[model samples]
Target: MNTRSFSFRLLAWYTCLLTCIFVLLCALLYLDLSRFLEHNVEQSQVRRAHQITDTFLATIGKTGPSYVAGQAKALYEPEISDRFVRITQANGPIIYASGMPKDGSFDPAEVPAFPPVSSRESFHRVKLSNGKTLVIAALNYHGPGKTSYVVESGALLDPAELNHLVLQLLIGLPVAVVIITVGGYILVRRALTPVERITRAAEQITQHNLSERLPVSRTGDELERLSISLNRMIARLDDAFQNSKRFVADASHELRTPLTILRGELETLIENARLDPEVRERATSMFEETVRLTRIVEQLFTLSRLDAGEAQAEWSRFDLAGLAKTTAEQMSLLAEDKNITIACDAGQAVVVEGDAARLKQVVVNLLDNAIKYTQSGGAVQLHVRRANGHAILEVEDNGVGIPSEALPHVFERFYRVDQIRSGEFEGAGLGLSIAKSICSAHGAEIEATSVPRKGSCFRVTLPLSKN
Candidate 1:
């Protein structure tokens, strides 16, 4: 898991908070449990002290202190039971006291005498030399003859049970934390699944597919709202793109008639034998510019139609290798004018499905570009092959290769390499853009790669025709 991802961070914070709360609750429970057990032990001690006073000490007037001591030792057996007992007269004399316990858990001689009590009953805790805690409950007793005495009973506090509870909690805490952390991770992933879906859908909604919308979940949560908002944004973008394409198509159509008439008039003027030399030269220049403009306008119209999905009506299955071979042959004549050689490798037939005319345009554009950029006497090679169910076409040239920074934008409309913008190689820069639009309409991909000062290669991959 990525620690920087939202789900991981959320799970981390949740686990930390849960652990802190769990530790706090366990601490409080342990403390409350220990206090409850201690209170029960104190109550038991108080009951034992009352038993010593009422059952044995109450008979002091009838029998003697000697008889009471005999009865406590024989009946109660304080020493064997690991209990402490003592009795004192109102003045100061200690009448009865327990000896060392049978287990030797504590030395009874280390126990202190009970202090004088203002109330009828009292309790005290003492720490012995053996690192044991002793809880003593004392009661003041009055005999039948107005004889007064203090009765004390105590037992050592044993932490064995509380220690067992601590061990259990200690063992269970990590297990509980692990289980909760796993559960929290799962919940976080499920919660963010919609966002992930939205991200993937948004990535696919580029300018080519502006009409597509992200899937909207009807859960009425933030994810739903986000999807709806993104859909609205895409709708606005689609409208803007439609308007732009409409303007380009309309403008290009309107300019064609005027350009045609201007070219014809210039041709007629140039043919006139009586025209001045300077006027004829200017007319020829104007004619050339008009031809260039007309070509750009025609390319723009084609690109707009491709963008609008109007070029798919002429889909057909044809051999891609044959098409590449034919287009390379035709473009080679132009390459010869520059003293450039053209090589075509169409060894085997690789068939594909698309608008044949548009695919031909793509090949023509790539070949023209390679021939235009290659140095005189340099070579251009066109390769066609079938690989992994796709038809691959590559156009490579030993030209002044495009810079690495400009390779990505070479197919963008009107983008020209700054280094190669000389008048001799000047162009309106719409050929590659038109080719890329046509490729996208046919579900093909076009990419360029170059080694500066070495050569450049443009590759087109189209899915093979199943038929």
Candidate 2:
């Protein structure tokens, strides 16, 4: 009962959700990538610092400021003030350092540890006990592992720069999000316009108005296919509804005649019970009427089971031609009494997988109808062949054919021809219908074609059995 259209809303929400997810993923990737680049740059800078230190240590060994400004330490400028570098020797005495290695008391304890403890890059920033941050890099040279020159460097990060980067991201994210939200909504709405039309069309269609169909652009896209499919469904619904209504009307009319006869016989017997013969005759007639009614009910139940997909076939591979020949042979007598000849043209062996017993019944029913309805001296031919992956079983009779308008209704249940209304020739009119149902259950199709006073042919096509 809740009939809200979900096309545009669902599309919009999906677009927004996808956009948000991608944006978050991009944001995380950007931050991680930036950190990775920065870490690699810091490592490279540290490696360079270590190389500078190693050069000095290789030239100068174990000496104090008394040997300051050694020839090997001349490349380092003292003007690079924020960093400290030095070459030391045995007993940890500074033999050379920055400041042209000028005489100065730059105490080792106050200057901080040379390559401030680090796991990678031989580099780190450390705060001295007196409150100054220094970045250091080192390499051991001209001595055992610990005895070496040390190089240190520093670059202070401004507090304002960090704040500015954060501000840029915060401001840009909202603007992008707002623009994407609006644009995505508009785009989704435009894309789903056809869907919205389908929804509205579906809403407007009721049982009485199933003739209404969804509008189709026929663009061959999924949405267009959806519209076409919906329209087809509506067309089928309208057709099925009409068939049901007609079936009900026809069924009621067919049943009423037998019931009317039964009632009339019963009413006559009660009114004239004193006439024993008449009463017995009336009772017998009523019994026959009841039997006919029972037959109709059983056929209806059988068709219902077939329609509901409850009929399972007991399948086996068998010769369709053999069955056709046998059925035609048996019907020869009935045809002969009307001066009608029965001939068969069965080929080598048309094999098909199906319910053999059920299929034989279909053949027998068709043959019986052909014989019963054919004029005297008319011929009934049974042909069985294999063609196009199907076992074609055909029954053609030169008899009183059905009208073209009535051909479509011949397979419908309880449809009897007006010309064959006599009790002897008249049947329950369920033979062809039951035959059709059986063939359908076995994955086959049966059709009948007829021309008035000319002839009729019923064809049953069954898939040929590979086995």
Please report the candidate that would top lDDT against the real structure: 1
Which residue runs does candidate 1 get wrong by more than 4 Å? 419-424
Q: For candidate 2, what is the total of clashing residue pairs?
A: 0
**Residues 288-308, model 1: lDDT tens digits:** 998988899889888878877
Q: What TM-score, over all chains together, does every model reach?
A: 0.94, 0.43
lDDT of 1: 0.88
Question: How displaced is residue 85 in candidate 1, in Å?
Answer: 0.6
Quantify all predictions' global Cα lDDT against the true fold: 0.88, 0.69
Q: How close is candidate 1 to the true structure, as a TM-score?
A: 0.94
For candidate 2, write residues 104-200 as lDDT tens digits: 3233345544423333336555565545444445544435455544444433222344456567767876776777767776776788777788898
What's the CA error at residue 191 for candidate 1, in Å?
1.0
Error of 1 at 90 (Å): 1.8
TM-score of 2: 0.43
